[model samples]
Target: MVRDLTALTTDMSLQEAVRIFSMTRVTGLPVVNDKQQVIGFLSEADVIGAIMPRSRDMSGIFLSDFGEIARKMGQARELSVGDYMTERPVTVTEDINLSTVSETMLMERLKTLPVVRDEKLVGVINRTDVCSKLMEDREAI
Candidate 1:
């Protein structure tokens, strides 16, 4: 797990979140409250989905011109992380076993999981972290 992790606040704007994502090169980040408690998660997918036009038909078809796309993106930029973040995100405790962590990631189809202690933000575990630890354990055996 990465002990040095970047966290977002609920009130942060989507534009700021995008900037953070670009700077950190992370696909997702955990959102925390003022008490540093994990509350939600924001991902690139969430941001993109927020700006994209939702399909109105059962066939899942939609059309938008560049102007419409730009307008939606402008609106998204004014929104806060809370508006699009996944609330009550799946998280792991520090004591969780590696297998359980891996299973959770797979089951949720998540690339990252925030590690919490006493409901507070602590660190994060990514797919690479799990795979590397597994490989090291195998080599040690």
Candidate 2:
């Protein structure tokens, strides 16, 4: 588990979130509430979808004109993370086994998962975490 995690608040502006993403090189971030409970998730794709034109399936077809896309991108600067975050995203408890986490990630197609304990965000698990754990186990074996 990665104890040093970056999280965002629902009221944070999309522009700020984008800056965080760029600085951290993270694809997604957990959105927490006042009590530090995970409430939603923000992804780079979500931000791009808000700015760029795309179908429901997220196919990158160039249907909109440059002016229209530019206008939407500009409008997106004022939007908050809550406006585009995935509410009630898949999460896991800190005590969950690695196998279970791997299975959940595989089944749900998640890249990252927020770790919670007693309904509060504690850490995060990502594909890198899974791989690192597996490598460690292999080394032990």
TM-score of each: 0.91, 0.89
Please report, in order, the local distance difference test score of every candidate based on alpha carbons.
Answer: 0.90, 0.88
How far off is residue 130 in model 1, in Å?
A: 0.7
lDDT of 1 by residue, 1-141 (tens): 899658999889889999999999899999999889999999999998877666555755345445666887877668899999999999999999999999999999999999999999899999999999999999999
Model 1, position 44, has a per-residue lDDT of 95
lDDT of 2: 0.88
The TM-score obtained by model 2 is 0.89
Error at 114, model 2, angstroms = 0.5
Q: List the residue pairs that clash in candidate 2.
A: none
**Model 2: lowest-lDDT 10 consecutive positions:** 55-64
